[model samples]
Target: MSETITVSGVVATPPELRRSSAGVPITSFRLAAGQRRYDRATNTWVDNGTNWYRVSAFRALAQNGIASLRKGDRVLVSGKLKVRDWDNGVKSGTDVDIEADAMGHDLRWGTSRFARPEAPASPRSNVEDAWAPEDDAAGGEVTDAAPEAAGPSADPGRDAWAVPGDPILADGEPASSPEEPTQADVPF
Candidate 1:
């Protein structure tokens, strides 16, 4: 039986999206999770060795992973975990891969905005088709164009939460342009 596991780590490589011969969309990435600790002998913070994992996502998760995550971003991934042994012509080693069910940016690292995709009209339509990229040419390799940024607004002053500059009201509207919301304006 596959074990479900959750892990948080920094993205070590850009997510690469590809399609299987059967046309299933898949995305994979390398993650580096370092263990940090205070060394009593050193009297300072130190990083224990880092563990690496290969993360794999299928279907819509594959598409979203490419669009939402990048190298150096901190993310939390939860899914079925598998370990496999591999041997090249020269050497061999065991590798760990997680078939992700859910993945997202770790909020402890920073904030994130969410936008849901529109539902398909017909259930019969293939979801993978929507996630798959068009081929540049028949039998040619797929282009690796970077997906547009969807993390934060271009304007630094805008956040939906109750920040000093942009304060969202009870009704979910921004404060008036005349003035920023004062301490009294927020309900608490």
Candidate 2:
């Protein structure tokens, strides 16, 4: 029997996606969850030991999980948990695994942006494909040529990221060689 549980942890391993013998998609990875305690004596947080869980997802979940999950990413997983005893010829141990029902990045730990994936040959893809160069009969490598600049930049040779009104010439060369700013030069 399996128990439903929610686990928040860092993905300890890169997710691996594969096809089953029956052609079902499967994605699996290892998760590491650790406990942290506030140590008043030291005025700091201390990490306890970590628990490891093997996570697996199937079907569409497997495909998306493989695409989104990477090692060291903090994730929240809700699923059925299984504990089984295993005894190899040389050793005996217990395995903890989670068959994920739903999983995603843990927002509390960091920020994430969500974008729905679309099928190929999209309008944006068509525009991108136009920039790609075709391979020749001798060279079988396909690569994208440098994209054309939209138009002539107002100052082509100038660093586009230069400070608003510091020192630049019409030809886009620096008016003077840059020097480290002393504390006095700071407005603040």
Candidate 3:
């Protein structure tokens, strides 16, 4: 079972926004959370090692992250905790990763104003509408700029993620409008 965890940390790097091969939005960054201990002899807080984690967010959260977060900012992140084992020729170790469900600036250090992202014109459109691409100044219209594919092997050939009105099968007919989900759609 995956465990949910929350950690407040300083942003160690700039947020990088990229798209998966299936056209899903994603963002990732390094977070550094430190610890301090009071020393009786010195009567001062002693430095303790800092724990580092890589945090990743998907879809709307990913978009919001690009707009809201920056390097060195104190932020709160809560999500599923994943511990991964890794090995190189010389050594092996575990790395911590958080698949963030929610993230925002920590208000304790400073104040922030909340602004709701603009609503999409229609529900039928995808969330990509929330982050529109910039238009070229030369007046040439460019549509369907493919998003960055997910991994090293991701390529145009593998991009078959379905969008609204896309054909569900290879029969070449457009799909009908999506309907509300029912109990069967729930994996649980």
TM-score of each: 0.65, 0.61, 0.64
Assess the local accuracy of residue 45 in candidate 1 as a C-alpha lDDT between 0 and 100. 94
Backbone clash count, each prediction separately: 0, 0, 1
In model 1, residue pairs whose N, Cα or C atoms come closer than 3 Å (at least 3 residues apart or on different chains), thus clashing, are: none
Model 3 misplaced stretches (Cα beyond 4 Å): 122-188
- Which prediction has more favorable TM-score, 1 or 2? 1
What is candidate 3's local distance difference test score? 0.78
Q: In TM-score terms, which candidate is top?
A: 1
lDDT of 1 by residue, 101-172 (tens): 999999998988765465545565565444432422233333322122222333343433222333543233
lDDT per residue for candidate 2 within 52-151, as digits (tens), equals 9999999778988999999999999999999999998899999999999999999899876554454445365454334432323333343222222312
lDDT measured at residue 176 in model 2 versus the true structure, 0 to 100: 84
Report the lDDT of model 1 for residue 10. Answer: 96
lDDT of each: 0.76, 0.78, 0.78
lDDT for model 2, on a 0 to 1 scale? 0.78
